[model samples]
Target: MSLRHTLLAAVAAVAMTGLAASAQAKTEITWWHAMGGELGKKVEEIAANFNKSQDQYELKAIYKGNYTETMTAAIAAFRAGQQPDIVQVFEVGTATMMAAKGAVYPVYKLMNDSGLKWDPNAFLPAVVGYYTDTDGNMLSMPFNSSTPVLYYNKDAFEKAGLDPNSPPKTWQELAADSKKIIDSGAATCGFTTGWQSWVQIENFSAWHNIPIGTKSNGFGGLDTQLTINSPLDVRHIGDMAAWQKDGIFKYGGRRSDSAPLFYSGECAMYMNSSGSYAGVKGNAKFAFGVGMLPYYDDVKGAPQNSIIGGATLWVLQGHDKAEYKGVAAFFNYLSSPEVQADWHQFSGYLPITQAAYELTKKQGFYEKNPGTDVAVKQITLNKPTENSKGLRFGNFVQIRDIINEELENIWAGKKSAKQGLDDAVKRGNELLRQFEADNS
Candidate 1:
């Protein structure tokens, strides 16, 4: 062979090797989340789908325990310089994540920096508002957003001689029907709730168009003070406390511990995150129904939109540029209408994007399911007032624990409703102040 032919052959071989290496180079993005059980499987399925759709990126999703544990782990990992590329922090952790200036990559900025197409207005306002900074830029990508709803056993309602189709709409009616259910021995308890602080106070205030704190529930500034000890709050909490004494309202353990009470038929009514739809549907032996949360009939502008409860996906700092690109691609894939709709329907979480919600409706999913739209309607019925948008208090996880302690006192009859709530406000405000000081 001639020398020129040998040199040409060697150059061709080198070029072929470079092509193979480029084909094999793929970015791996790590996502740490809180979903467990069936939901965790769904999260894995989503990651699998994203992985299969492209050869340039692979998503590795890890379940890091519950919401609090997941957030704590991410923060600890961040401090240790081993944080995951993405973390799912519950809605209560929004303020904390936002305050950690150097710890997070704001979702809006991340998408834009990666040149991904993102529309902040395409998402449901109430769902996105919780994670948005005061400047209106979204800090996290909403993943599994939900609102509280009323769940009832249809058979239990019928046995109590009440109309199964007509669930209670007002608190007064709820009280009357709850008494009927108990007196007729249809269930061991009339009603029980999970996340007492979430359902009974935070959401309760938003649903009634009452401010939970002085500065738009802390969305305005970190200096906000708790105003949850007002007359309406006192009246509602006191009434629930009174009902506890009369055996009408049962105090189940906090944070979805009471879900079994309804599913096992021990409680006639249950109030919890709409995400509980999956658990109740899977476990209930009898027919069940979902309804909008009950509210006071006489309060002006009452029955306003309820706040969201689920978590969002936060992109953490210190990841590679390639990983951020992969993260942006994954987020954009998740935001697609088909993917978002499937996640919403399968997981019983509210569809976070307007397109997803409309796509679900256009597909006739709501018509086929009947009451599955209750959460959607309840959250979007009115433009969110300052009170209805959502809460963003600092150190909110601890504040919720403090409020739960005070509420437990009310349930145990150790303190009156007014006193317990007042004490919660006082203690919670101190933590807020401390958080402000620490973060400021």
Candidate 2:
């Protein structure tokens, strides 16, 4: 009732009004990504930069474990009606996301609906084609596209009397070089690889220009069947099994567990995603060289282009128009030549747009970084055929698990290469069929 009390109440009301106005000024866009460690920092930096570059939106980046975990979390959130504005899904989960109908906003359509000028043609064909629907519409924004590349320890190569400048181009050469490195006191083992399903099976088939399954590796339609039990595949698996016995190849682990074998210098070489450049550059104590994935010398159309494995940004549904606009603006910012080039240079991910690649080259990034261009060159080495462009199998995460288990069986001498591969194909096909039934 007093004059001083009235003034105090008015001041408190003004303060609350200011707080509400400040919160309403910028729409917050939450992004869920799977980039961890140094890569996670890069994602956060990008979000901060975007937030600072605009007054209309606050881009909040969140790390949600690995690729599989991130995707699983996103889907679960969607089911619970608490999905983030954007989610990063790995290339392997492409089919599952595509099948989710109303859950995704379709990046191309989102950009159009938001009235943001978008040219899908500006992106690299390999990157764009992978995320595009059969109708040629872009499903997700290609954020961190990467392909497999061979990394070898230069010091180990030199100690083993192998040419440090020259990396093995053929499987035969790789086998011989691996033996020389192992037989000598250079390394405990010749080589190890991460993502047995990806590096050993999927990319193996692509680099050799062979199909892992019918219907163009599941790119054509849902009606597909695994053909990983082919003669070439059997021979390659059999060779790896023999190499394991000879101590030329070691099953370091799954996914990226084999990375330490190469980084610790226990293994002379490693085959993994090119996005791992930042990690290897950070961890390896010895000088290293990058090369294309090795292929069998006798196989026709061998050494074809390697496919990508990194994640892409999908625009999730259920956001308001203001939020969608923010997402579009953030996507555009992320796709800019400067942003893309910086990400490609710093994180070793491929620049989704051609302009970014050109900008990187003009900046002499490739020359300064040396073997960094190996992935770009290998990805665009030749025009992509159905078998080499990329794969689009359903339930591929489960398929990859099946493949890893089958591969381990062969490597551990529990099953012959043919038997292991046959069993994998049989088991994987069941999942594929189930996926078709569920999606259809």
Candidate 3:
């Protein structure tokens, strides 16, 4: 009960306090995402799973507006030395992200640094090729890759006297069916598209195996030209223009803004990302179906694989070694088959790994869900052609804006599709050249 006992009690209390702090403290990793609504919820759910599964690290996801805003924030934050550990950048931002070599830690390098065994073959070639360097090293992890596909209202098709179970596989068939839907008054608009630049222009070239640009669509190098003015591209746009005149096709909005029209049953057919399934399933009042993106029946090698349009997770450079391990651990968790399969099922994004696809198949997810496998089949049905590999051009965000402006003029009858596209190519090419010069 003297000085010795008092000193011993104080030391024991201090030891207990240290143990408690060590037990409760957890390393936190910040993830900046562009998802909102249901997609945002799914991202949080995945993060929660990772947090619950391990005590070593905790992932914190922050939605940083849409794709453009997210990319801009990441760049600004990196400059300010306040960037999150992970940033979600869209497919269009691939060139921009790759060009920022000083700001990024290549996903392949991160995986290897963490000693995580990652197999490139586990991803769909078309999906992985978009985010990889020429040597096929992954620059980012494909988080929510999706390609354009057809969405149709079955009830509208039946009312239009077309086969509800069958969707048009060729551009000609789509036109004819769209006309029928319009004539039958099945829907206010026969066909509408979300992300006209992404689906019709960018993926149109890929699906028909026509080049969207030269220099390997910018994957080979940065000095790429806007070739959407090609004969085939012109022909396709011209047809769409003629259809717009006939009321067979309606221009929804610039980028994925037409989704609501389709979901509202105002449009009989819609063309958009496979990822749109989540929105459609949530909002569509009528029965719906999904099909492969249509191509020109007469085009040689038509119906090629479509390129991805979703975002990927890129690890920013300059973080400490401990933080890099946390990033790698989170990536590994996200890439696991169970996590990937659940994410694919919940969000309609295609699973990025082969193991995830196999796990989904084993779980009978496809059989029970019916349309869930459409993305996998569409992406893997054919090996990616030169055009189908993916587009990788500089200043693509501005280029897309230019394309939207030109396409809007065409839809408003201010210009012919051929005239509009030709002008888009000319102007877009000038911008591309300028970007090339500046970046190079």
Candidate 4:
């Protein structure tokens, strides 16, 4: 061959190789999440796995802080035009996210725009309901969804002469058992709970089949009003206040501050998110058991499905098409049965997909771990009522703080339960009005 032809052929081969390398380069998608510790590691693992499985995309998982902190950071970043591609927002923040119309790119829209096959029906009804809009469009991808459950130290139950296997199923039974545990010196206190507004008031109202607020707990409209100061709410809170006074129920600080109380063997019984299973299993020294959240047996339609407590991954707006395509791909990867099931087992969170749940059952995970199914069963036991589906109050973060302040007052004996809750409702309504005015 001629020397000129040979040189030209070699240069063309090198140019083609360079173009292929550039084409194969990955589009990086940033995900800011609230998960920490073991959960955080799982997030990293999921990202790493997705990165390994594909050449077109890379997911970078960043732990911003706790749920509130992570959300705040995302909002700040959005305002600064430096937001991540995705941010995990807790269920309570659903209304706020919905109100920020321009700031978020709905998951349904993102998937559709990216040419990904999306089915809202593939997810558990209750899990998806919380993050969906009134039109039934999914706003975010459900991740690490969980419900509150009763966790008790079996050793404490045995020492207290209660049946370690049969955990309390009703409010009265819980109180009775808690008193016995305290009296018998089985533990320092009877019971404590985390996320007081979530577990105690929100789920508490739903579990009793009562309205947390008018307008289907704000699902109907932004002009919702709080009904949580109703007779039922007052009665339940008063009962808890009485227990606190009797030293039968200890009032641990908000969120998961009470988690240590249970695992440390200081508190015999605790109520928190089912997702805490991994934390308890890894940290608790004593034998422990999980049970359905207790309810007041006297209430009509009691023991309803508990509401979900975890966060969902929301794709933010203003990202490039390539980055969004990467987000869509990563979300699809995360939602697969294999990834979802593993995450469900590893993190003690509910599987977001029906296929994942069924896969876990087929694998005999529930059979091997007796109480691990409590949260799943509790969350899916019955068809969700408007009350049980979940809450959507506006300005929930501030409203939650208001409720917590009143609850602290009740715990401190400075106010009666009725008075505290009534005040919370009144004060919370003003905030709701403000949110409505600000967003409307």
Candidate 5:
């Protein structure tokens, strides 16, 4: 009842309120990603949702250009000790990311350190395997994973006197159908592709169960050699060259440069990443259908699983424990079924979890969008063989550039498929050896 005692209690209550507010303040973590357009919006939305959910941390998503540019920037930032808490690296950069000593904080380690009980089994095997180390520990979290698929203009197929409902299931069928489309004037070109090496060499070898390189595609050992220039690979490229001459297949530049051809209605058939679905849906004017990528159909174990093409989230090493905790929490939020399903349905990326796939299936998202599951079915219909799992090699970005050069020579009729690929393998092996020595 004394005025002095009452004043002291009031002041203590006000100070306690201030302390509680300060304790619940969020820790900020930066995430540098390569996503743009609608995908970028989804990333920001996820961050916003997580920031509102628990108030323990806030994830800041920053656009850092495309895959190669993002990786380059990350490396530069790392050298300067200014790297973000997390960086999205493409599948091709897996080896480079792993080889960088003390540059990355493994996802498993971060989760464990933060007391987050993470389950590796929750992710699709083919996806998780790409980011996991030789010891089967996950080095990064798989997000926005995708695989190549066939997209055809149904109107073009009908005009060519082919069954609009049925798509080419084999390479022979696709070639034959493409010819008809061109001959019938259904499109300016029958078929065109983005990233010739990615669709033709990388996923092509995996889908056909052919080795891209020795030693389990370089994951088994550090001293693996380039073996992608095999007889089967040469034969496939030779067939494509012949098709090019016959005006059935058109060659575009690397990556998704050919996407404009398909979107502009110049190409009747396209083989590109499933992640392009969102863009195609917005741009295509005619009725379109999606199908699984065509394979040889006769190769033993043909129709094997296709590897992913998108990127994953890797935590950088120099960040403090508080930042790492925020990174782990953000990853956990991103991996939930609701988030995964919404993303898969929105952007055509494969749902990284069985629960997300099931959620989409139950909600009839696939039924409403008939071809939405084509990528999922193509990647999961068959178990992954050694060849189908994924690729890991140092200086792979340079290796991809070499592949582009050789394939371009073949397309331009300057070299035969066998010769071009042989030269690429030779040049690529030198880089591989150098990388082995440097990282050893």
Candidate 6:
């Protein structure tokens, strides 16, 4: 071969070798998440943006199914020593994640160790409080936090002769309005709900200054018992059961299966995660307004702040040291005001950082969007009391299922509200006891 051709081939070979080495040197960070549909696409976009912003790392977000399935997959993968660097766990799975000591790298320590300028106080209390240890140390990074809000059809309200701009603020007013809506045939049913256990029981107890369990709703310790059968709880559940018979309240199904009922104009109002804002905006055919979750005015301090739903980002163990720094960088990027505000504006999630919230307002998002701020206002309406803070019982995921089943039984006439709730408490306490023993 000629000397010129040989040198050219050598140069090409050297260049190819350099490219392969650079690719190998890039740190790949894996994040397993539960975000699905358009939300999942947004997750990918965020990851892609992060990848483009930095050359040292590449992030890959994989959908691991629903919240429960994502958590389960993470746990199983951890046991197999193959867990991702990060996982998205629902608020209900907080206890499970906390119990997996040595498996999780607490966000506080992660940030501090990485020498990042992280201020714990920068996060909104109502959202971050759920994933903090008793010492007030944050265990996970708050992401996609949301609370229940009242979503009403404005067109239906006007037809029913109710103020379209005003939604019911109290339980008594809600019932009266629901009757009016049904009687006037503005909608087939007055209202339906999503997340029956979450909205009906968990937030219900919190909003009314009642506890779902003792020991500060399991924040105090693992030894906690369900107080879900309280007098007020029974009364509320019984009222819902009665309303079901009169078409005032419809139990369309569980875990947001009923959301279509509201979006399709089958029901006039819905109580669901504020995260549903984006979905409702796209799907609903008529004008809708967001309102705070209704409270019973008769109860003193009844309108206590509501607790949050949605999930947090947990940094899992078993990744390389280089990857840890990448994880920290990714988290910092995710928490930046610009990124967070954009996410909140697009997805209807509560921006975890106070700075993000302020940035969003400064951007005139709430002013232009109207009811988009209802979740933030409702959850931050008052300082969270012990009852209003949040729940953290171990085995709560399963307990939530038991609560749902009992509620279904009550709605189906197999048992009264009081009896079904009583049974739920009894059955849930057994699981709590088991969790306590295992975690203790």
lDDT per model vs. reference: 0.92, 0.91, 0.88, 0.91, 0.89, 0.93
Badly placed stretches (over 4 Å) of model 1 are 1-16
- Model 6 clash pairs are none
Query: How high is the lDDT of residue 393 in model 2?
Result: 90
Clash-forming residue pairs, model 3: 195-256
TM-score of 1: 0.95
Quick one: ranking by TM-score, best first? 1, 5, 4, 6, 3, 2
Tens digit of per-residue lDDT, candidate 3, span 131-213: 88888899999999888889999999999999999999998999899888888999878789989999889989988888999
lDDT per residue as tens, model 4, 1-440: 99999999999999999999989887889999999987899899999999999888888999999998999999999999999999999888999999999999999999899898877789998889888877888989999899999999999999999999999999999999988998899987889999999999999988888989988889999999999899999998999999887777898798898888888898999999998887888899999999999999989899888899889999899988999989988889899999999999988899999999999999999999878999988988888888888989889889999999999999998999989999999999999999999998
User: How much is 284 displaced in model 1, in angstroms?
Assistant: 2.4
Clashing pairs in 4: none
How accurate locally is residue 269 in candidate 1, as Cα lDDT from 0 to 100?
91
Off by over 4 Å in 3: 1-25
Worst 10-residue lDDT window, candidate 1: 243-252
lDDT digits (tens) for residues 1-440 of candidate 2: 99999999999999999998987788989999999988899899999999999888999999999998999899999999999999999999999998889999999999999998888889888777778776778999999989889999999999999999999999899999998988888998988999888888888998889998898888788999999999999999999999998888999899898898998999999999998887898899999999999999899988778888888999889989999999999999999999999999998989899899999999999989989999999888887778877889999988988999999888888999999999999999999999999988
* Highest-scoring model, lDDT: 6
Q: What TM-score would each prediction reach against the true structure?
A: 0.95, 0.92, 0.92, 0.93, 0.94, 0.93
Worst 10 residues of 4 by lDDT: 243-252
Q: RMSD in angstroms, all models?
A: 2.1, 4.7, 3.2, 2.7, 2.8, 4.5
Clashing pairs in 1: none
| TM-score, cand. 6 vs. native | 0.93
**Error in Å for residue 323 of model 3:** 0.9
Mark the 10 consecutive residues where model 3 has the least summed lDDT.
Answer: 116-125
Name the Cα RMSD for model 5: 2.8
Q: How big is the RMSD of model 4? A: 2.7
lDDT of 1 by residue, 1-440 (tens): 99999999999999999999988988889999999988999999999999999999989999999998999999999999999999999988999898888889999999999997888899999888888888889999999999999999999999999999999999999999989998899987889998988999999999999999988899999999999899999999999988887888988798889888888898899999898887888888999999999999999998899999889999999988999999999999999999999999998899989999999999999998877999999999899988998988998889999999999998888999899999999999999999989987
Candidate 4 residue runs with Cα over 4 Å from true position: 1-22
